[model samples]
Target chain A: MERELKLMKGNEAIAEAAIRAGADSYFGYPITPQSEIMEYLMAQKPHERTGMVVLQAESETASINMVYGAAACGKKSMTSSSSPGVSLMQEGLSYIAGAELPCLVVNVQRGGPGLGTIQPSQADYFQTVKGGGHGDYKLITLAPSSVQEMADFVKIAFDLAFKYRNPAMILSDGAIGQMMEKVYLDPQVPRMKEEELPSWGTQGKKKGQDHKIITSLELESEKQEKVNLRIQAKYRQLEEEEVRFEAISCDDAEYIFVAYGTSARICQKAVDMARERGYKVGLFRPITLYPYPFKQLNKLADQVKGMLSVEMSAGQMVEDVRLAVNGKVKVEHFGRLGGIIHSPDEVFNALLNKIIGG
Target chain B: MDIKDIIKEENLVYKRTNVLTENIMHYCPGCGHGTVHRIIAEVIEEMGIQEETIGVAPVGCAVLAYNYFNVDMQQAAHGRAPAVATGIKRVFPEKFVFSYQGDGDLAAIGTAETIHACNRGENITMIFINNGIYGMTGGQMAPTTLEGMKSSTSPYGRDVEMMGYPLKMTELIANLPGTYYVTRQSVHTPGNVRKTKKAIRMAFENQKLKKGVSFVEVVSNCNSGWKMNPVQANKWMVDNMFPFYPLGDIKVPQDK
Candidate 1:
């Protein structure tokens, strides 16, 4: 019953939360904006504390494959990296998804066409939410706008990942990763016992146990299509059952600011600024980026005159908002790129200029 | 002698290892993979570790290796089997873990994973089948392809100036401090097959000692890839591949 409270950076909070959530292993390489995640785990020596194995991989490619190996054994495994490192992991990620394994991957965003900046950007929205690797797979992506959510979403992402037996991702940015905030650290949960391991995992068989084979390759097109259908069905269930969002002051608003992660924070401030000036603006934050809040946004589109999709990218998430609205209301996008964090006034003025004034 | 009487248990000199399943292998006739697979199965059976072993299948001809190995198996992406084996061994240190990889998988695209796993000394066995060509992809040039060796990609013969020299991975990895045992053997003959089997057993036994990587490289022949009959290919391997690859131990454990 002892709940510990501490001020920690978002990356550090994720590491601690993963241990508390009974993660079996974490394989990672050092990358900017998120190196603290692995550093915190290594310094904490979670192997001594919670029996969690922390490995510093040679590269993101190796780290993700390690996660794939652990997940195939039905272990609660995780890895974290920045943009370019995550790009290197796309192949392994696709393999993990195809094999229907459960693991967590955290991408602490940095600006990039290719290593654009060490500063935060939401440019990977298309990559994370829209099948970044290859094939018709969807990762259960959670966007954390605050340090507390950064910690909380680790456990949430893992739970959802295991629930669907699929890979999940935490999509945060450099701002949240580096920023320190109050976080409620959950008590340690016991790691799963050997007997508790999933039957489908590739762990060695005991006497009278059946041999389990974990693979993504199916040479027969008919069988492969069946697997794809099953995966798509699971994604549909996720869409129906697991859409998470937070609507602030949206009850009677005529204009809404839709964003996530750091931009969502900025949009919240902008929302207050707009309301203080009597413009009736609200903020809508989509927590789950993959099972997007489509229905809710579509419903809200009926009430609102327009919505501004603000982000730290060149208008990535705006496409999703546009799809959700489907022309029910005008959806405009405004943002800064190349690691520029927009101010509340800038976002407010964007909403006024892009949606209201012009 | 009646057929049934001749097939009686008492008359049996050898039986197929139960560690191998009833499923037919997809490997080509006279291919080295079948021989190596049988050798591994026999080793697991002899060690009484069939139920306690996990095997990683690489992404080449043996991608369907899981269908044949009657133990827990994971099929890894091309060149990522070592990393996968590292993950499994880290989680289940007491269980026997190994990766079965081809030359292209171990020496080409997955070179980083292979070298790092060996360098980390990850307490896993790596059974490398070096056929000197990309057999599964229809006789393409491989990292293990010898100088002036002819493959589909190297139809005009591998020009050392253009294609680079062949990779001697077993010798190269033996130099890494992480490796506990490294050996190169071939199965072109019954005597060599026995030696390769013994080498594989020694490699797996090294795992129980918690030593680093135990690598057993099988210098194999690819008749289909080489555009020759199985006999000719075996003869070609004996005449050519053995001189460059050599059939001997590259490293072994020094007494503590």
Candidate 2:
């Protein structure tokens, strides 16, 4: 039997999980809500002797590049920031993706567009999933709703990044980042064996084998197209194999709630409130935003009369919901932005007005 | 035998012993990159750090420096070699790491990365090649181009009315408290090449001591860009570029 763990905030859990997952380096600049991550790692990193480097960069740009460099050396590395900082990391992120280097980036998203407030918001949904940077690449995006998941997902993110040889992102909002809950730290997972990884990593050139070069540049059009095709195939595999979600009370309900990250938490509260008032409503939470759990949403669409997509952004994920529903059920969107998180009551009322009656 | 034959025979001996070759550089006949590469390779060999050293090559001419150096190397995206070097050094603090960057790749496009890397006191070495023009891109004006120097982009001789003055990166980086050693040297003459080797060795030594960021700006010639022969290009760099960007050690940490 597993023992119950002590309460911890999601941000603290992520920091702890990264260490437990065998991250060798962390580079980040201070940003609201997520600063605790850098703080926690900085305090603990100096004690470890098996080569752990923690650095506070001059800016988000520098932080991401530091991660880029460390990752190139075949070290497990990470960084964390809120929306504005993630925006600054876009250039480096593109390079990381292009170079096909493995690293984890955590976005404890705040409201945005500019220097948005330091409050919790999921306005970065489109940016996170739809390739925010100037390229045709996708980052493996994970959405964790609970503190336990926050701790668990760091390891998962690292695993996926290494598996795919690409960047992985944990898209949580300020609320999830700051919220406190019980978390049990698992025994540290062992890193993948050298043979299991692509032999191209900078572990040093082998004695007889020729020096391996890891580069994204393909000067020939045919070669570039082949790489693109490979990337697309991997993305298709992720969509088929990695889609994850949670569904609640959908068997007898005619209306459903679709949300992710912090919005899902609020939607859960709304579902509970609606059930209390004798309104049969259900909730569907997508845990993987990129390889979205569209199959689950489509199955729910057959029983529900309509689906309400609530987010902190202005209906970014709603497009996905509509595509999943594909006219089988009525789909509508509600959102708030610039650091404004929607209240449970607001979502509950909106569901009632739009799906239940009005 | 002619000088070429002697150099070739010496190169063959070098290949058997020194791990670097005297192969004619792929750079234009008079480009300064070859000189810079020779000095760097000499310094690394002299320091006996070939096995322990890692180099980062940028997106410009030196992007292929990895092909020449016998030690391990990693290539970075345009203007990002310094950041990559920072990462490598931070994780493997015991390893000797350096970045060889060019005018367009470092001073212009990668200015933010270079400045912040220096300012953050990352324990790494940076060899900045300031040729006053983007040689790899066919004679474009670079951030270090003198105000009156003409290039493909600034065909009007870089008018002060429009284009800005040449940036003195060493002088600028010297002001940052995080930097432990900052120097501007040249590679136009045999004496200057020796001076440059000393500067590079000093920077590498600083990293060995974990003293923090060490920067060396090599005032170099781009004969192809300037449309001058090798000797004239060196002369032009001395007569025109040197007065504006004088060479010396701007800062060396007292602690070191």
Candidate 3:
């Protein structure tokens, strides 16, 4: 089917794409930057047309639990919030992962340690990728830099979520969430209609069908350990098969800049600037932040002289870069904190000064 | 009667409802959870809504309630059952949705969820168990703990000036316009068991009519948590717990 290309804000694109991807329910609270998601859905009235359910929950805590309830029934459900709201959802997120439910969570991150600025920042890099919630689990995290990806990755995130029976997050930031760009949205795909609901879902199984129990509590330490080990194994598989990244000008580049999301976009501009200025600083951006692309980063580390991590936050993802590079090459970080996004010139200058002789 | 005669199929006077699982109860010998579970299971059997019922279990002693309910079940994080149940009921309005919660999970940690869910008039059932103390967490002070109640957290006896009076959550929710039927019942006696079962049945029945939230609170006993024998716990409950957390209907729909 032919798709229509529409100019959409990243937050708006997320709502539209979720509906097009056949999400059965969306429970969200009003939050800065990403509030447009629920606002868009409400105005569009997808519930009347596509039979989707859009509800403004009392809080981020309620929103995530609502998603948990519906997702436990094997439905494609989602919730979106900004950084502060995301913190409130950690408890439910932990349970959702523990119960092995499939759902989509979009975190349009703003600057934060407490109640920080309502501007774009990749400050939650460690929080989202390292499982901000309690316990040993991993969320399949995708960082979207463009409004197009903000739209496109909704379906992809839900797909990966259901495929692996794990929660998937689109780790976007306020800049991309509020920015407008051309995006092609596929036609409305009906919600997943499995011939038979997954055996794990709470769909009220009939007589003789094994009663489905969705829970994260295991009293027996031995049993809990087995479950933890099983989740760990799945994560290992994700590292091997789901590690995603984009390498720009890395084939014969001496300097490599590592970043993601909005910062990655800035690094792209820095790459162009470096090339124009007769230098060879390439950009390596990890699309999936959780899997981290360690193998790819290490291989590139063996070739490049050094790596400089450019981000909006105070050097969160840079730690991952160091771990991946493992001192194979000198790695440095430059960041504009408290929601101050660095300009292309600033990032280029940092690359020139930190990695190359200024 | 001879052994052969007594063993005849027709001679069977009672059998367990298929709605309950084979898992032996993890509850202490005198806990009210087991009886309440039986009553709910029996009601489901009589009502024939087992296949359409989805239960949200709480994070207290009955956290493993999912294992016992034969219907599809989801375990909610502490105090979020109402919100979770609201989600299920919203998505599948035709299905029977209910949340099983304890006093600590409901009145204390999850007060906001409980109020909001009811205020929205969600067509679901809420089963609240008030045992006065947190059983699974080892006799911690619950919101429903009386002013002079003694628990692990309130060892010096709850002082009204410091710890506050017991929270009457059932009476409070009765004021919410979203609630169709609100009642507080008990399961310590055979007569009370019958009444509580009736209350549970009505809660489930109202969901079929899409009649807003039906709230049922059961004042239960936790002998082990109370540090008393089963018989003494029952006596203690009737003497100390009754006046504070009285049983009977708090708010019933006019027509009903």
Candidate 4:
């Protein structure tokens, strides 16, 4: 099959890539910046083309539970929402994580502590990386900065999710979700056959097999503790092997900028502006936020004078950057809150004032 | 004849369904959940769909129902069993899927899930156990608790002015075009038990026919929650509960 290249919005790319990735079902509710994902799926009629199922649920709570149901059957299920809607899904996500079911969730983030603005923001960094709901669990978080990555990470997130038997999230923002760019969508991968499904799935019992019971409940405290230990071990493994980041011109840099998703894009341009002004500056964009590239940042901390954590929030990801650097060198945070997108020049000025001047 | 001879295969009048596991139920003594679970197991065995049936257990007293039902099961979050069942059935339409929930789960916190799932006409069966109180949470007020019904949350005989009226979820859902069959039954008596079993069998059959939602609400007695003994609870259910949640089919398929 030929690789199909087309100009598409990031949301449309997510929808198209999901169908081509052979997803079995998508359950979601309409939310700004991410509503186009379901819209594209419904308009494409993937049910006729690839036998995929698309449903618009009544609310985010319902959407995530539906994903939980389909995922329990060992199907490739997914859901997408913006900030407030994603908050509504935390309980279901916790249940899915506790049950050790594999699925994909995308959050095209908007600003919020409440019904915040529909515009782009990276305020959900703490919510996504740390345990958002009750209990100790981490989503295999992937941050996509461009529309192409928006299409590409859908397949990648699903693969990582199934490989680890854990939920994976594409932590994008409204900018990437709504922006348009050229993307080469992958060829169709066939959906998994019934025989190919994992043995743990609760898709009814095969002859001579014990009943497959998918649940997160363990009344015994000892058993629950063991479950928690096993999950922690998996997280350790992810941190050791799955930390992904991109470094641009950090080989001989005096200052460094750490960011993710939309912030990373802005910092890239800021890095260019600083280099033009004869200051050695580099941008470190983390792709996997949960298995954060802390070790890599620590190595850079030895070489750079200081680091600035840039994001569209009131300094959330900066805490992780500071932890990674661990006082080896100065680390500061620069952000624009409540749906404000900081320009490249503004980032350069912050880099000079917060990191260099300080 | 000796007892062994009386227990011979040919002389056997009743036996437990193989679809039910040998595991002991965790339900309280005289609780109706066990009987309802048995009827469902029997229906699965009779239909011979045990291999293709999936059950969703809710987060109430019957939360551990997965342990007793000898089939594939998924335990859902509080009040989200219907949404979960929708996911399973949509992905595997040929399989029979059902969600078992309680009064607090279905009629209160999960009302949106229940209403939306039924409204979408997902091809699934919903088994609702309405015992009028939150039995697992220590007999708190439930949306199905009768008027002036005293509960832990409603300490003063359920002041109607403050507590409001009990919900009739079965009749309410029956009005939706998505539901193909709706019925309210009880298991306080042997005859009623048989009728309830028949209703469950019909609900499963409706799933096979791909006829939208088939809702079976069992108005049962919760002796532990009601602060009454098993016998008194049954008598009280007959004298008080039936008048509010009368038994019988609320909807059925019309002959083509």
Candidate 5:
């Protein structure tokens, strides 16, 4: 049986969940709103043994490279930081993704553009789901709305990273990362065994066999194009197989509230208040940002009159909503930036202006 | 047959015909790389580690060292061999891991990785070749080039007043407490070659024993970059570069 927990911050949940999930290495430089992760790992990691290698790198560059090194060896590894530090890690992230190495990176996002503030923000929506670094690539981005979801997503991120042989990012904001809540320490479900992992891991080549090679470089244009095509095909398979989301009372509703991560939490409050006020409103939250649940959105578009995209960025995810709606519903955007989080009242007012007042 | 007789038979066959016999070496004739490769091959043969060893070739001239070395090798991005080797070694710690890097690759762009790896005392062997100039990139001045040494980048010679003096990586890394063994050797002549082979063997043994961070810096000559015949470049390295970067073991823990 499962029990309802009290409350825990998102950052603490990520660190604890990573520990429970058998991460062997945690290499990161501290950044605001996410320092708790490093602190938690430093305090609790040594006791676990489990070959945990926790190092405070001289810089984010060093930290990510260290993670790259550890991850290449098939060790479960992770790192956490805020927006600025995550920006610094983009190059290494790209390399990890290109090399098809499994690792987890948590972004407890604060405001951005350059040391923007330590407040909560969803301004990295585009950067996280789309490619943050150069070249054509995508990260498996998990957007969590609660501390429970944060804990649950940690395991999911690790599983998906190995499933796809790529990096998985937990995109949270300062409000979720810093908020205090209770969480379960142990996962109720079973974890995978080491032998279950892909045989490509460099644990030592088979006896009387050639050594395995792990590299990202393919000098020939045709060979690189083939690799890109294979990656795209895998993404397409994910779109078909792994898209997940939650729909809250969208049947016969006039207006739909679409949000994710912290914005989804605010939209939930707005939906509840709007329902109390006799407005026909509902909410749709995307759990996975890359393999976006567009089919569900497309189905909702046929019924709803308008969809409001509530984000903390100016209008990043609104583009995807527009594509999913496909001219069936009017798509509108409401957002705040530079670490300012929107309240339920703000989103409700935007809904009123777009749907009721119209 | 006895083991010695079997070894002699194999050596005789290898002398007559080997897989590496036909590959046109891009390295200049008499370049130290050829000798270095021969020594590395001999070491692998002696230690019986060729099948188990994984070598990382750096982005400079030895970037193509993979072509000649009959072991499984990976080519790293410019100056990223330490980082790559760190990955390979951490994953397969039992494998005999080593990185072949040049002065430009190790001391210039990859300085941070090399220093931190040594400081962290990673159990790996690093064969650092300090040729005093960037040979693969057309005679560019390297971080280990002697003061007042002219190259493509240092048109008026590397002035101490302008560009800083060449770096002595062995002395610098020796100061790190994590370094277990740090030696500076040369591969210029027969005597030095024997010393270099001994140093290489010691480094491999250190890794085998799980002693941390064995570093061997080979002060070599880039004859093409120096615009000298191979013999002249060897003499120049002995005359000018050795005094600045002395050859000897800078640090070795007494316990080891």
Candidate 6:
């Protein structure tokens, strides 16, 4: 079947894509930059269309817990929120990961330390890649650079989530979330057949071999450590097979700009501008922020003379860039904070000052 | 004459419920959790809905409640069982879904989930155990702790000014328009256990009616947390706890 093309906001694309992807349930709370997701879902009413449940939860905590419940039932479930709301979801996120349930969480991130700004920021890079909650676990994070990618990643995120039996996050921002772009919506994929889902899901015992329990608490330290190690093994496999990134013209380049999401978009323009100045610059945009493009970036470091990590925060992601670069090339950071986004020209200027200029 | 002929299988009047798991319960000797688990298991067996029931376990003394019931069960984050049950019931509406939570898990930390789930009138049963103190955390003061009652966190007794007052959560939730049935019962005595079992049955039945939320609260005793023998704790619960948390139906469906 031919899928229709639609001009949609990134957040709306997420909602529409979720329905097209046969998501069983969506739980969300309204927040700036991401409010369109719940609004679009409520207005679209997937319940009538595909028998999916759409709910406006009282809070992010309840919303995420609802996702946990639905996912534990082996249903495709998800929630969308902004920075502050995502902060509240950390507790449930940890439990979902620890319990090894598959779900999707979309964070249309805004600037923040505390209620910082409704404007976009990339400050949550460390929180996303490094376990945001207590104890160690990994979330497969997808960074969408455009509304089309935003729509496209919903299906990808859910596929990866269920395949790995772990939570997947679509880490978007205000700009990409609010921007309208042409997107090719996938034709509706049928929800998993009843028998295809895990029989261990809490759907009553009629079809399963034994009574199922979806709990995270192992109690005993030694046994809990084994659970942790099992999770680590999954992460290791993810690192090996799921590393995704966009390498833009890095061949024979002297300078490279490492970024993602909206920051990556801005870096694209800066890269073209820097190229006009004959600096041999290119952009390295990581698609999966967790199993980051560390290997590629490290190899790029050996090729490029210097690198600049551009972001929307006070250089949070640059730390990872530095760790990957490991002094092979002097990696410096350029960012705008408190809802202030750096213009492409400003980024180009920063690249000049940080990486290009002597 | 064979003795087996005198006591035939059809003549058997007493037996353990088949719905109860073979796993040995870890509840304290006198804890009401074991009593409640038995009642719930017996109800499922009697109603013949074991294949259509799902239970959500809380992060309290009955944290391993999944091991005690032979139903599809899920373990929720601390104080989030009601929310978890809401998810399950919404997804599989035909399944009988219930959340089992304790005072510290429900009244103290999960107060919002408890109230909101009831207020929204989710077609699920919430079994809240009010022991007035935290049992799993070694006797810390719970939101339902009686005034002037001493606890690990309240060494000098609960101060109204300091810790606020004991929360009558059942009374609070009963007022919500979403609730179809709300009741408080205890399981200290054989008679009360029978009554509590009836309450649980009604709650489960109401789910099929699709009327609204059914909230069954059990004002129980934590003998170990209270530093008393089980017998003394039951006596104290009747004399002190009952006066504050009177047992009876707080709300009932008009159709019923």
Cα deviation at A81, candidate 3, in Å, is 0.5
Q: Judge candidate 1 against the unseen true structure and give its global Cα lDDT, from 0 to 1.
A: 0.94
TM-score for chain B of each model, two decimals: 0.98, 0.91, 0.97, 0.97, 0.91, 0.95
Clashes of 4: 0
DockQ leaderboard ranking:
4, 3, 1, 6, 2, 5
Candidate 2 clashing pairs, residues 3+ apart or interchain = A111-A339
Candidate 2 chain A, run of 10 with poorest lDDT: A204-213
Q: Which residue runs does candidate 1 get wrong by more than 4 Å?
A: none
**What is candidate 5's lDDT per residue for B65-178, written digit by digit as tens?**
766766666656567677667666665678888889999999998898789878877788899999899998899999998888989999889997788888888899889887
Q: For residues A132-218, could you state the per-residue lDDT of candidate 1 as single tens digits? A: 898989999999999999999988999999999999999999999999999998889899998898889987876776689999999
Instruction: Spell out the clash pairs found in candidate 6.
Output: none
DockQ scores of the candidates: 0.84, 0.47, 0.85, 0.92, 0.36, 0.79
Better of 1 and 5 by TM-score: 1
Instruction: Provide candidate 6's TM-score on chain A.
Output: 0.98
TM-score to native of every candidate shown: 0.99, 0.91, 0.98, 0.99, 0.88, 0.98
Error of 1 at A337 (Å): 0.3
lDDT of 2: 0.84
Worst 10 residues of 4 chain B by lDDT: B247-256
Residue A302, model 5: Cα distance from true site in angstroms: 2.5
Error of 3 at B186 (Å): 0.4
Q: Which runs in model 2 stand beyond 4 Å of their true positions? A: A1-4, A49-51, A189-198, B1-26, B45-48, B229-231, B248-256
lDDT accuracy of residue A304 in candidate 5: 84
lDDT of model 6, residue B6: 71
Tens digit per residue, CA lDDT, model 1, B1-256: 7898799899899998989999998888888999999999999999999988999999998899999999999999999999999989888889999999999999999999999999999999999999999999999999999999999999999999988999998888999999999999999899999999999999999989998999999999999999988999999999999999989989979953
Give per-residue CA lDDT, model 4, range B1-256, as digits (tens). 6888788899888999989999999888888999999999999999999999999999999999999999999999999999999999989999999999999999999999999999989999999999999999899999999999989999887877888899999999999989999999999899999999999999999987887999999999899999999999989999999999999999988842
What is the C-alpha lDDT profile of model 6 across A1-358, one tens digit per residue? 9978999999999999999999999988889979999999999989898989998888999999999999999999999999999999999999999999999999999999999899998888878889898889999999999999998999999999988999999999999999999999989998887777776688887744678889998989999999999999999999999999998988878898999999999999998998888889999999999888888889988898899999999988898899898889889999999878899999999999988884
Which parts of model 6 have CA positions greater than 4 angstroms off? B1-12
